[model samples]
Target: MTVTIESVITCPSCSHQAAEIMPTDACAYFYECTSCHLLLKPLAGDCCVFCSYGSAKCPPSQEQKGCCA
Candidate 1:
């Protein structure tokens, strides 16, 4: 199976969304909403914001290699 690196992250505060390329070496813990400027963090049990709000999981999670601590 090929793991996709692209993720469409949606901002919960303002519903803004963006397609971003996830880095394979690390997890993205925070994301800022472009429309509302609200800083987002991983929700409980989520390793990164992408896992919690993105259409695709973070690269680490996609590879089943675990994400942020």
Candidate 2:
């Protein structure tokens, strides 16, 4: 199955719009805020981009596999 998800992040420091894609096979650990140049990481207990921003949770999380598993 082709698993693709999109999410948007607003930099807390600069209010920059970051449109990103969540990978199905891997979890992204860090994201650089384009506008503020701040490095973004998953919030406490969050697994991936979808869990943080997307309308739906990450695929693994949805399956109860947890993040990056």
Candidate 3:
């Protein structure tokens, strides 16, 4: 499967959305929402903020390779 690098992260607090370029080599452990400026972290069992709040999973997750492996 082709790994996707783009993800849309929606802030839970304000419901604001932003498109982000996912890092291929590392997990993005934290993200700050552009609109609300709320800090976001990965949910339990997820590798990155993208996996937690994004419309698409992070690149590693999409590729089926364990994130940070």
Candidate 4:
């Protein structure tokens, strides 16, 4: 099955708006916010930045198997 997720995330430190593409096969550990040039990584124990703060979960995590595993 094909999985997808979309969300608007703001950097916690810089409040930068970041539009991210959640990968179906892997978790994104780091995201660079274009607006504020902030480098974001998943919070401890989270799979991706989306999971840490975005309104939506990453595509891999949305699957029944869970994120990147």
Candidate 5:
């Protein structure tokens, strides 16, 4: 499978959305909403904020072995 690196994160607080570049080396634990300033964290059981709220999974999560492996 081709690993997707782009993710669209929509802030749950204000419904704002932004396309962000996902890091390939590490998990992004927190993301600040550019529109509302809401700090976003990964949902329960998720590895990173991108995995929780993004349109695509984080790079680490996309690995064949799973996140943070």
Candidate 6:
């Protein structure tokens, strides 16, 4: 499968959305919402913020390689 690099992350606190590039080699544990400035972390059972809040899962997960986290 083709892994998508881009993802749209939505902040639960302010409902702000931002497009971001996910890391290919590692998981992004933290993210800062550009609009609300709320720090984001992966929810339980997720490996990265993208998995918990993004439109797409991170590259490693997309490729079925589990999570680098």
What is every candidate's alpha-carbon RMSD to the true fold? 1.1, 2.8, 0.8, 2.2, 1.1, 0.9
3 versus 6: better TM-score goes to: 6
TM-score for each of the candidates? 0.91, 0.69, 0.94, 0.77, 0.91, 0.95
The residue pairs found clashing in candidate 2 are none
Which digits, one per residue and each the tens of the lDDT, describe model 3 over residues 6-63?
8999999999998999999998999999888999999999989999999999887887
What does the lDDT read for residue 18 in candidate 5?
A: 98
- Off-target runs (Cα >4 Å) in candidate 6 are none
lDDT by residue for model 4 over 1-68, one digit each (tens)? 66556778888877767676666677777888787777889988888888897877887677767786
> Which pairs of residues collide in model 3?
none
- In terms of lDDT, the poorest run of 10 residues in model 1 is 60-69
**Candidate models: Cα lDDT each:** 0.87, 0.68, 0.91, 0.77, 0.90, 0.94
Model 5 global lDDT (CA atoms, 0 to 1) = 0.90
Compared with the true structure, the alpha-carbon lDDT of candidate 6 equals 0.94
- Model 5: weakest 10-residue lDDT segment is 60-69
Compose the digit string of candidate 6's lDDT tens values, residues 1-69.
778999999999999999998989988999999998999999999999999999999999988889974
Best-to-worst ranking by TM-score: 6, 3, 1, 5, 4, 2
Taking the tens digit of each residue's C-alpha lDDT, what string does model 5 give over 36-57? 9999998999989989999999
Better of 1 and 2 by lDDT: 1
Instruction: List, residue by residue over 2-50, the lDDT tens digit for candidate 2.
Output: 4446666666567777677667678877678877778777677897645
| Model 2 worst lDDT window (10 residues) | 1-10
Cα misplacement distance, residue 65 of candidate 4 (Å) = 1.4
TM-score of 6: 0.95
- Rank all candidate structures by their lDDT, best first, as comma-separated numbers: 6, 3, 5, 1, 4, 2
Report the lDDT of model 5 for residue 45.
Answer: 91
